[model samples]
Target chain A: MIQLNLHKTLSSTGGKMALDLDLTIEKGHFVTLFGESGAGKTSTLRMLSGLLKPDSGMITVGGTTWFDSRSNIDLKPQQRKVGYVFQDYALFPNMNVRQNLEYALQKNQDNSIIRELLEFAELEELQHRKPETLSGGQKQRVALSRALVQRPEILILDEPLSALDLKMRIKLQEYLLQVHKKYKLTTILVSHDIGEIVKLSDSVFEIQNGRVIKNGTAADFFGLNKTSAKFRFSGEILKIQREDVIYIISVLIGNDIIRVVSDPKEAALLRIGDQVLVASKAFNPIIQKL
Target chain B: MSIVCVEVDNGEELMSVVIDSPESAPYLKKGKKVNVLFKEMEVAVTTQKELNISIENRISGVVASVEMGLLLSRLILETNIGEVIAIISTKSLKQMELVERIEVVIMVKLNEIILAP
Candidate 1:
């Protein structure tokens, strides 16, 4: 369990923003900090990683004290069991992929983990390629592999996938989930993309003006079900048959076929292959994760 | 009567209630607007929080008015979304100690909601 009571003050164009937070995240849970810019999302991650200082309060992880303002106990970034992956993929330009992983090793540590990480991230072929030569996805994989070389307790990701394209981002999301489960590490992420947030996080903390305004299970917090009258898969029209004045539109949804009742002209403009929703009065909300 | 319950967004809130088939209520389509209609007697109110039951349609509101009678009582609940009217047995109403302005949770069963377009 990672528990924190953090307070910080920072100056922005909007004036002094006070970041006061008290949040408890369960162990092994992937939590995302979501908010607009200057909302103090990134600062929270920095404080946890010991890169940024808080004005006051304490941070504890799994019965170990990481920071306490009163006791003046502040561990160095290296002292805390943390692996931080930045948005820019902060790979060492001078070193290749393998060397970057080697750099995170402790003094006199075994080099076998380097081979393991290289193979795990599928960077065995690109082990000698410099950061500049690697694609955005390749560079991020290297960065992720390098971070895990420490086998840290908490993995901190600061918008790490935001720089990549949609396809790459999706591929990286799968890698992240695999890594999170394999290492059993508590992960904290800062992200703006709601799609990724929904895909990756078990819980979400929505911060605004430096405080956590909303926090809950990801589905409950973001999934409002505000769309049309609750058609889970909103089917597509495959065929339309005239039954007197009314029309029966055949809808092909996934592998199932559900027909919809429609009047002439839609009640106007519903054609074949167009997405049609079959809303039934009996079709009700079945509480499920979105 | 054979019924169909549909959910409606009354500009401020999404109200749902129902039982209907595609043939019974053909007006209900995806991305279309509809009206929600349910009975006052169908609205159930309680003061409990974070319940784990199967009621899907719910709202938190305060009693706008209460008309007490010997056998039954009528309650008008005012929520940010809209108002909900409820009718309950006077005996149960007295047991719950309900009064005007008292915050309460109103719930409706899935089949109780009716949709009209």
Candidate 2:
């Protein structure tokens, strides 16, 4: 498990915030820190990885104490086996892609693993390409591969896809999703994009004004489903279609068709045009009633 | 049986609701009246706050140019409202229909505005 309970402040000219956070992410779970700009998502990530020292609190990752202010235990960044990927695919300008991955691995580890990571990250063709030569998406892939090459227990990604274009962001998001599934990594991502958080996160922590206001499953937070006390629009069901075991129904609201997923058995009870209600809540993504 | 506009943000055209319920559910056989409820009911104050702030109600502009950068996306939206530039994220660009002379919706939250002394 990765546990962090720390308070830190950033005192830059334009940015200043006192962040007090206490979060525990289960092993192999993807926890996304979501908020607006200056919400302290990046600061929290930096504190966890020992990149920034917290004012006070305990942070233990994978049973190792990364920072414990009371005990005065603060491990160095390199001492913690953490893969940190910044928004800018910070590949060394001096080294090629192969060398980048090579540097990530330990001196005693096999070279074949680097080749495998290159293949998995789909950078096999651009092994010799420098950071400047590769496209934005390609550079992101290389950065992700480089981080994973060391097989770190915890992966800390700070807006990894935020730098890319719209199309590139989606592509890299899917790629990262696949990588997480394959490795079951305990990943922490900081992003302002709600769609990205919805697509990639299992759990979402809503940070506003340097504090976590809400914490819930991604589905609940996005309003995809799971009930909450928020403004909800309930529409009438238009049609129901059967797709294998699932019954998909469309609810009509002012020419808009909202689709809801339900069990086939319950769907069978309703006629071809039975009246069903679709509930969509405010502050959560639109969800069709089950 | 009626849906009324409760709050008007951009010139009464773009707004939210205080709907009593639709006259009828068009597609469904069974329909019932929905009691419109305010999402924020715990507020102490009953009166609404209206402040006189210079807001860009509308903007009429061309794409002018699309500056796609690492952090921010600046869209020079030229409209009859005004040739105002808006900064949005790249992820939000997918949802935007940026065309020449397109009327875009610009929402200004009251909390974001700093009250001058």
lDDT of each: 0.80, 0.66
Q: Residue A107 error for model 2, in Å? A: 3.1
Candidate 1's iRMSD: 13.4
> Candidate 1, residues A1-290: lDDT per residue as tens digits?
99989999988899999999988999999999998999998889899999999999999999999999999999999989999999999889999888899999988888899999899899999999999999999999999998898889999999999899867887899999999999999999999766677778999999999899998886556642332233334545778896544466788754468766554545368777674445433354466788
The candidate that wins on DockQ is 1
DockQ of candidate 2 (2 decimals): 0.01
Model 2 segments more than 4 A misplaced: A14-16, A226-290, B1-117
Clashing pairs in 2: A222-A285, B58-B81, B59-B79, B60-B78, B60-B79, B60-B80, B61-B78, B61-B79
Give the fraction of reference interface contacts each candidate recovers: 0.06, 0.00
**Colliding pairs, model 1:** A265-A268, B3-B19, B4-B19, B4-B20, B5-B17, B5-B18, B5-B19, B17-B113, B18-B113
Per-residue accuracy of model 2 over A204-254 as CA lDDT, tens digit each: 998876688999997667654433223434344678886533557886543
